[model samples]
Target: MAVFFDAIGQGGSDGHPFYDSQRTEHKHVANGGDIAVLAGISYSVTDLALGPWIIWDSTLGDLTRKVSYGGVDMQPIGVIQWGGTAPGAVDAWTEVFALAGVPAGEAQVVAAVWGGMNSQRALRCQTVSYTGVHSIGTPIIASGVGNSAVTATATATAAGRIVGVFGTRSGMSGYNGSQRFLSNDGVGLLMGDAPGTGSPQGQTVTRQNDGPWAGLVVPLQAADTVATCEPLIVEPTISSRVHRAPRTGGLRRKVFKVPADFQ
Candidate 1:
């Protein structure tokens, strides 16, 4: 029977490709392994991609890239890849979030943290064509810029559902000092693969690699490169304690502690 079904393997001995091809796809404790980033890269930034964007940690204090020339707004930590030479590396590791090797170079800050539902089937694209088109990016409009450019006509990437929305401080309010705030609700691209929205303070998400922390992360700056961390993340250790991610992605791996008389 076809050599006993290729000796019980798939397309065996070393040709395995019968279908699905199986591929890949975290940390922060907020994304996996621990998660923390802060060193350099963030002024006009340079090269980075993976999921979610905009992370002000407080800028200068670290985690700078957006808020434009100053950084104050917040949201995004779900980069999951990039940081090969060190720009903060948001990489979640799955072949360096694809593009391969030393994460193929790129990443600086954005390892996702703030928390709540993500993963979107590893950011599938399938060429693009989101069926019913309730939004095409993520229904209900997340906000940033793109508003359109998601093109490609058909192949199917899943087409979203519970997409994110809330920027320009959708709830508004800021002030922490050495940077590092929190707030809430940011990442999206949820059900049926719906909606779309980039950055403009509206919510920011789209440098297009699929949108929403899938790309447009930017930071990379370990002088030039290597040691890119990945095991999920956890190489700095600032943790005053906030880590909360895991509705589908991860983080919130646990580390509360703050009531020692309210610190």
Candidate 2:
């Protein structure tokens, strides 16, 4: 949605009415004059109309007022003047606050600014509050794991099953390159490997009764498959004393067969 920053003269002028500028119960600048306005996702406001003022985004359900603009007395609307150091430029700026009927009690300042020419340029405000947080989702075990404490075992005591892992950390590439250790006995752990130090060591894990198993498993390969293939026996053909089936055909046929013992 496009947000408008166009300003109309609040005085007598032949300008169209801005119905959506403020709340429905509140009155907008009627019979306002035409003034140059800027609007966009990356637009900046001045101290005059920006400071101590109530700013609104498309998603805001209620009007939010700012407590102070650049540490000055709070006002519903703020005005700023830039280029004070520069000749013939107004460098002073003010911020206006928007109050939700109640004054000085539990009011939220949606926006604010510090005093100075580079105040808006400071870009110190937090954008996360407006954007909201997002989850990366849980990670899946790529391999089975066994107790790392044993160190002697080559693989898990039993066929290890993957439980869960993290896809990313803090919205960034999560521990992707880092070595991960996990135990089914609630001993899953991740560690960062530092240079000059021996390989990263697994931290002790305390398994909870309701947590994963005590033994952890990780895949040596990208995916898991059956351990071994069974052999098939063949009898001699009509002319040959003994004949063996074709490796490909024999394995395919043997694998395709349904067990007679299966109900």
Candidate 3:
């Protein structure tokens, strides 16, 4: 019962139409636990019927949760078209969104773009840590197009249940604005057992997309205890730095000179 991967925050929004929206703030100095915030987005448009929206700011303690995905007729898994005329003629689009649990400390992940075109957006936040007695389920929007492999099953009524499968990549149009990290275009995450129920009951997790706009995190255990399907890379303890010095004495020193034609 140990899962940890903390630190990685990013935010962006240019070509402003009043600065659409963007936020990625992840700061956890240990002590607290149970947190998962994974988000992604990339955009640039001129209207191919324009579309791409995501908003997530899962606040904990006092409660202020929110979740939203793409719109304006969604159907994207990497689409492309640049400066109009005749290349692909779409404009630009990229979306890979995810938000889980988020109840640790300092975790603000948001992304938005509703109206007023002229867009250019980006947001990424990945911070995970869970140890002993965990529960976070409710977000399983699966569809990897051709379905090379995508599965997510759940059944852990009680008894040390640890299942974590996170994923992104929902309706992505293209223009290649440098193709932001979708796991480098061949997404993969595995934790087996759910094909014929031959193990100690049942618990499965698998994802292998080879396009772009992707996201994944699979970790399961408990429910008769027959676990595998584990690929939730964790690495991030804490390291913050900031130091500057040049003042030590408590005395005073004053000097007044002349001005010889701007010497």
Please provide TM-scores, in order, for all candidate models, with all chains considered together. 0.15, 0.14, 0.25
Arranged by lDDT, best first: 3, 2, 1
Candidate 1 Cα misplacement greater than 4 A, ranges? 1-57, 64-146, 151-185, 189-263
lDDT of 1 at 174: 28
Indicate the TM-score of model 2.
Answer: 0.14
**What TM value does model 1 have?**
0.15
lDDT of 2 at 158: 22
C-alpha local distance difference test of each model:
0.20, 0.20, 0.31
Please report the candidate that would top lDDT against the real structure.
3
- For every model shown, the clashing-pair count is 61, 45, 9
Winner by TM-score between candidate 3 and candidate 1: 3
lDDT of each residue in 49-163, candidate 2, tens digit only: 3323513222122223233212233333222222213232221221122211121112122233222122222111110000010111111112112212211011211221111
**Which ten residues in a row are the worst by lDDT in model 1?**
1-10
Q: Give each prediction's root-mean-square deviation over alpha carbons.
A: 30.7, 27.6, 24.6
Q: lDDT at 45 for candidate 2?
A: 24
Backbone steric clashes in candidate 2, count: 45
lDDT (tens digit, per residue) of candidate 1 on 1-263: 00000000010001111211112111011111111121111111111232246331221123222210011122223222222223443322111111101111123222211122222211111100111221111112212222222111111122221222121111222221111222212212211112222221122322322221212212111121236676675455343444444455554555444522231
Candidate 3 per-residue lDDT over residues 1-263, each given as its tens digit: 33333444433233333344444333332224454433433343332223222222221121212223221111122212121232222233333344344444443444443433324433233322333324333322333333234333434333323232222232222211112223211112211112112122222223232322222222322222247788788765654444445446775444444333321
